[model samples]
Target: MSADESSQATALITGGGTGIGAATARRLAADGFHVVIAGRRRERLDATATAINVDFPGAASVIVMDVTSDASVREAVAGISRCDVLVNNAGGALGVSRVEDGDLAEWQRMYDANVLGTVRVTQVVLPLLRRSPRATIVNISSVAGESVYEGGGGYTAAKHGTSVISETLRLELNGEHVRVVDVRPGLVHTEEFSLTRLHGDQAAADKVYEGVDRPLVASDVAECVGFVVGLPQHVNIDTLVVKPVAQAAVHKLYRAPIDWKTEA
Candidate 1:
């Protein structure tokens, strides 16, 4: 992979204040792409941009954006002229409740951020993407998007919409230079994802990954995004399902200590 150190290539990441988004911004910036990170928090965005600019000066920019709002997305995106890569990583789960007892409002927020938010941003950026010689849109979906579980009612539905959108858009954009990538990650250990979902219950969030060995980190997913975008525009990785060795599937997880020795 080569670096466009001239800052001609632009990659925009939503929910980029922290976690996977921030890591992706750093990786992309290191690869010589001008990175624009968008999120609702000004402070977090600034921190990420500052960190990136340390190594790649003048390669990081931040835009305050709320994906759920139309005006916010439009106004934020209007500042940039070209976008070669867009990473939709702005959404998160609210509650882990069964369908029978799920909170309707929580579901709404999930849909707005995970599903509709992608639509709103894509609608506005379609023209800009079309103009790019080699463009790719990466949606940070989840394992929940592929299959359902007992307590994943709202999140799963929303992510399923995200997964399908990636599928539909790929077909819709046939013959175009743009590539739609759906990155579904499983058992990623992140700072805010579970805390925000559990309403700031630190202990509960900690226990969610307790006993699991080497769960995927935000940077691990960032590495995936970096590799995908670095590939030739003609090569497309349609759907990538990422999980640690501890996780073989949604229902299957090894909680015991995993042996690291590789048999020769």
Candidate 2:
């Protein structure tokens, strides 16, 4: 909750106005990094920045940028003097339709946000990261990238592309001072993720966790990112998959109620 006098690392987190992005900003700020949270919404971004700065003092800032645009990302990074870490987390799913009934525009939007947006931000920020004493790039992917389901075609494909980006970057940046990490989380119950995916359908969003208990929260994934970035430069976490106990796999979720009374 307090700032560390010696913590000078600067981290730029995209989609940082809310959800996992906002949580990671707080986590990194608490870890003593000067956190810049970038997103498209000014209101949400300002709110998050204000909250973080309250806890960590002036450790938090906001950059209003659309990751999907080169000019926006360029402008956003222009003011960033140094960047020791980059967290690519600005992406979402649009709808739950099957492949046959998929919306082309929605699919393209997903691809642009999840895949190319990461590419743009990384490309522009590579120089800043390269200049750092030690740098880390954390890509926020999903277990859906590794598994398939009925209504997850577009999102799965996009996230798989994100996975490839993380993998290829790690290989390309080999022997460099930078560390590339891929964090894939499963069944996270954020306030807006499911709602956005369902296109503001409250009922549909609620059903996502209807019978589930203790689904992964945004802070859980944020903690993983914090831990990964906090490691020594010699350590590179290639890929990490985190899921709740209720979720055994992408296709298998334990929905039954817990029976606390039992014999050992």
TM-score of each candidate structure, all chains considered together: 0.96, 0.95
lDDT digits (tens) for residues 213-250 of candidate 1: 99999999999999999999999999999999999999
- lDDT at 30, model 2: 94
* Deviation from native of the Cα of residue 200 in model 1, angstroms: 0.6
What CA RMSD would you report for each candidate?
2.7, 2.9
Error of 2 at 249 (Å): 0.6
- Note the Cα lDDT for every prediction shown: 0.93, 0.93
Residue 138 Cα positional deviation in candidate 2, in Å, after optimal superposition = 0.2
Candidate 2: residue 116 Cα off by (Å): 0.2
The digit string of per-residue lDDT tens for model 2 on 103-220 reads: 9899999999999999999999999899887699999999987888998999999999999999999999998989999999999999999999999999999999998878899999
lDDT of 1: 0.93
